[model samples]
Target chain A: MAIDFKQDILAPVAADFAAMDKFINEGISSKVALVMSVSKHVVEAGGKRMRPIMCLLAAQACGENDLTQTQRLAAVIEMLHTATLVHDDVVDESNLRRGRPTANATWNNQTAVLVGDFLIARSFDLLVDLNNMTLLKEFSTGTCEIAEGEVLQLQAQHQPDTTEETYLSIIHGKTSRLFQLATEGAAILVGKPEYRQALQQYAGHFGNAFQIIDDILDYTSDAETLGKNIGDDLMEGKPTLPLISALSKTSGTDHEIIRKSIATGGLTELDDVIRIVQNSGALDYCRLRAQQETQLAIDALAILPESIARQGLYNLAMLALDRIQ
Target chain B: MAIDFKQDILAPVAADFAAMDKFINEGISSKVALVMSVSKHVVEAGGKRMRPIMCLLAAQACGENDLTQTQRLAAVIEMLHTATLVHDDVVDESNLRRGRPTANATWNNQTAVLVGDFLIARSFDLLVDLNNMTLLKEFSTGTCEIAEGEVLQLQAQHQPDTTEETYLSIIHGKTSRLFQLATEGAAILVGKPEYRQALQQYAGHFGNAFQIIDDILDYTSDAETLGKNIGDDLMEGKPTLPLISALSKTSGTDHEIIRKSIATGGLTELDDVIRIVQNSGALDYCRLRAQQETQLAIDALAILPESIARQGLYNLAMLALDRIQ
Candidate 1:
């Protein structure tokens, strides 16, 4: 299914992403070649390119067929997304990302930080060139929301009793805001308000599901597949939804182990923690919640006319959930 | 003179700065009150509020009659400046800033970084509200330039033979860009096209003078007056202009002492290093060069009609140089 989605929907958008790479590389100054080199390294180290692809696909799906603006918007979203990741790696102090050393790890923290700032500045430059105030305002607001979400997450770190409402808000800020904006921005460019709203709803739900799956995979997937160490979220002391949900449900021995693991933020007794979570049915619980989100995302797309892009988006949502388990 | 500038130009701007503080504080969600509180603590710690005050004063001097816009621009620039400092403290691993514990020191690195991100986002939010495209573009470009400067400085750290050109470029990025933008942005806002170019020129010269003085003060000033420990830059292996110039002139025994001292980057024998710098005439050379730049800044203001604000700016430039020695 992943291969099919990649072939049918993401292939054309991949070309757009390539064009973006060209644009950014061209923008690099000779004096700051180190910044450009490090930025390119992190950017070219492959992610799914899901956000840009969604943007391109959503624009196409809306039946406004000018590929140039869509492609630029796609690149802009991806660049913004990459900038956030660079900053996130610093904030998380993560040594690796996507099976490679992070920019911060390879180059010092200062380089990583400044390059992140450069990328953000470059993104805004590209955004202004797009010449759409409404789109610019939306994207800028989305960027702020993402930052706020990150701050909220930082504040919530290591606190075991973080409520579900807080968790949802954080995820919305950190994950869903950008995802929704990507689609919504594309729709705005395409000049379809109704479709833009529908795409935003679709992307928001999909993003929530995507984050849930990401948290679940943190526990279930090994380092090789996930491109990061298993239980990294635990080690980082991020009180993700699954653990919090399980803590609320279980008590006594189960609750104590989960609580201590989160507080200490290590895998000292990995098997024991895994056993507690498995026994508590936390994984299943998370998967059920993700599935529900995926369904809602699919429902959001029902308002749009049936098309390959819509189907591709639906498949992507399902893939987000299925990839975890 | 410094005290008077602080009282007149800076004090009024301080009131506006207070309003800006209130604006940002109100924007933060109650959910992350702790993070906001910590962020506010770091921001409110007594620093001269130099950048924002420059923005306000420059705007007023450019014949911008509206105090409110000038104040808003001042607050925005300062917020951006504060954001950079917060991130910089983390990158530099410094424990103190403005005679208080740094955000990174008080909290962890993650909180410092995220809060920096939050502040930057808030700055953008403020910029968007200002609805000035040219100002936004210049400010965004300034951010990129500043980050580039930081990266340049980071690359130059601990490199014994760092060139004068590289040193100048580094300072231009690290300090001059903000000053250039603050003053130039003010001029731009006031619709003073003729003075705008000169204001930027003045800012450029003044910023160079300001940073050179800062470097000189790192050697000459006590901790109380400087709000940072003398030799802090040396301990951090920052190859500032005075040291570079001193290195260029000296050879044999004195050169070796300077080299070894810089290589070690601590004040085990700080007094001895200070003696070598003083004896080498490096301090005098830097002081002379800074004074020249201040003169150039004053000359740049020749086109502007004389007013209290212009006199204040000229006095501020001279005061910056005087404060160093």
Candidate 2:
């Protein structure tokens, strides 16, 4: 049976999720018209809001009943996610996200860039209001690493020499670190110190699995299927896991072609590159890795109390994995 | 007598200034090579270190002799300033700042944007270590307003009907708000709540005076005199104070010309716009406004016990005015 996200995952925390969603709306309110409009556009364009939901689930799983602060934390997580997405669109020069025109596309880069900055600052502003020093420190440090991760990805662009270890580091920073913050932050907020490690572990592995799947889809899926063009990463010469693994498993002309594609980003050789990635067993290895990561994520949740919320987090991870299957 | 910045303003807090300068250098150190290089390049290209020096002087004026935390706060001010400058360069698509190549020019827009983000996160990370909720709230709120101000400026761009009140709001967000944070933050950190209002008032007015004079010089000063090109504001179609005032004080073809110049940014009618602004007495009115703001700034320092540090703040305001004289 397939996992139904609304029924199995979000059901237990549906009320909290709604409240958290409202907080996000109220939190991004600004006096500037453009800032407000662009923020609303991007936030509404946001897909699933998985991170904030994970935060809400993690809080409930910890057996903490009081949730006034938890809701705000959830909103902060989503705002930070939205802020990065806005900047990412500018960095990628992308015109669409989730089939909607991106902030950069609808408005100019100047407006997107400045409004993105506003969102980031506003996220921090809301986090400060939660009045938890531990949470603040974690977020501050986590956000710095997130930026570093983004820069590292840029530094690695087109370099075929980037190893899996380096790839893990990048994904951990860019994607998983925020996941860690969301779950671990919730645990800290709920006064459940013992659950911090378990939740961090769960979020870290789950985030790694999620990004690996995204990278795989980048090579395998097209605009009609995923709302993201196939070969988008290759177009940027990003040595994502698929290409990295493909480079290791093949040699001769095929390896050289993959390397050239990575070094010089564009789509002229995209068909050949995709064929090579598929034939070279790179996608298989990526699938195995994603599965292993998903299992570890679910296993970590065992440390949390056996509540509907923990099961919700578990179901959410499995549902993410079901995407590729 | 002309005020010497080194002798009159910096001398009182010279030792603290040097220490604060070192802190800025230490603060920007990052493991990522690109982040480190871009941050160092921008910091080395920094002009006068005026904001951080103001931070030091403000701390001293509050009768707080222990200089440890104050130096860090000073560094934070400079870091925040550099972050905005980095993003500003990207938004403006400029190659130079203070006669040096900007981060975007030296690297790329993508690199500049990401590094700017890293600097902002690092600043907040360091701020969290200080463990002061009130100070954190002030900065968090101040940064949000600062971003809104920048967006407001963008919104006002190429807009001819921008009001003086709106322009003040813009400058308050873009320029003076940070100055308020630099000084007012010092008061908050030093356990001097009594000094907060007066220091905030001084910095706010001083920043207003500073920006008005800069705008005045755009019409009145040449590249050789101020290292800023005449009619550069017109080139960007920035509805700054001179053009806004000119709009208020003119009509007929002159008023229409100013309005058109603002509505469509470029240097096509640079000379005519300059002449009209000068002949219409817009620059004179701007100068008078600058002087009034400067006087109000100096008057705010009367609440502080007269110390050389207070005098340094006063002299800093005077030196800014000296540029026009």
For each candidate, what is the lDDT?
0.80, 0.92
Q: What is candidate 1's TM-score against the reference?
A: 0.94
True contacts kept of each: 0.60, 0.80
Q: For residues A21-139, could you state the per-residue lDDT of candidate 1 as single tens digits? A: 56556444436768878878887874878888788778877876566877777777877888889889988887888878888999877788878877777777777777776787787
The pairs that clash in candidate 2 are none
User: TM-scores for all candidates?
Assistant: 0.94, 0.99
Model 2 CA deviation exceeding 4 Å by range: none
B-chain TM-score of model 2: 0.98
Q: Taking chain A by itself, what TM-score does each prediction score?
A: 0.95, 0.98
DockQ of 2: 0.88
